[model samples]
Target: MTVGPKARRSGLPARDRRVTTRRVREDQRERSVRADVPTGGGDVGVATDAEAARVQEREALRLAHRVVDLAEDRKASDIVLLAVAGMTTLTDYFVICSGGSERQLGAIAEGISEGLKQDGYLPIGREGSPDAHWLLLDFGAVIVHVMAWPERDYYGLEKLWSEAPLLLRIQ
Candidate 1:
């Protein structure tokens, strides 16, 4: 039953009906714009350079910690995490660990790769080789070094980047 304003004024009985009005005004969609560049002038959603850098730092640290955890799961020895963000522009963190042997080095590298992949992250590049007694997994924000005992001692990464803050170390 319908009861429109005009229907009651006409002294007519209400009738069952269904009606939908047309969009006579011709609706138009608003144009899209970047939030960082506000047209009306507002301070919302605009991050300063320092704020953006801090966010990046947090993400890099998280990735580094996860890599260290994965290496531990693979029984990697002498695991050391270095914060090289201030020292270099190459990567934010460096996770160096000893795998004891060439086979173990491969395992450690594979474990970190597999673990991070589950979280939707994959190494941007890989360098060296398992047979070479070392492997490098480049995850952009984090760089992992899976090295054999001899290689790790010879490379002396800790000595090379001694200035970089040692964030974590697990013997």
Candidate 2:
């Protein structure tokens, strides 16, 4: 088969040429859309989503540590801080701790919630009952899990997120 000079030079069939042109146009359109969207950095012109996410993750980890401190102060046991930012998109950090009893678990949860609240941060949602074996506090970028010793042992959150790096652990 004989090919024309232009077709031979371009090295693509007519159908492929059309598809390539369309793909280029689509890419241009996507770049335009991304150009208009503001990065979450607040007043810093433009940044990649990954950059913004890193900033958020740092802040979330800081808050997670604070929660750990509060729980420890309240005498929560076996506190663990997991850096889940690289493992999951759910939250940047998971502050998991065990309390000896339901009452102690409730006290730990309340201490963390109120302590962060005093810092002008409020949980987005709270689940599990304070009277139950497990209490979860969701703070958008961070999640706190206060569980009874038996619940913590049964759930094994640390094992579940075993791949996540352990940022802090207090026995």
Highest lDDT against the true fold, candidate: 2
Per-candidate Cα lDDT values, in order, are 0.77, 0.78
Off by over 4 Å in 2: 1-51
Candidate 1, residues 1-171, lDDT tens digits: the string is: 224775465465444222211121111000112114322356556545655555556667888999999999999999999999888877879999987677888899999999999987767668888999989998877899988878888989999999999999999
Structure candidate 2, residue pairs in collision? none
Q: Model 1, residue 82: what's the lDDT? A: 95
For candidate 1, the C-alpha RMSD (Å) to the true structure equals 21.0
State how far residue 158 of model 2 sits from its true place (Å). 0.8
Total clashes in model 2, counting residue pairs 3 or more apart in sequence or in different chains = 0
**What TM-score does each of the candidates earn?**
0.72, 0.70
Best-fitting candidate, scored by TM-score: 1
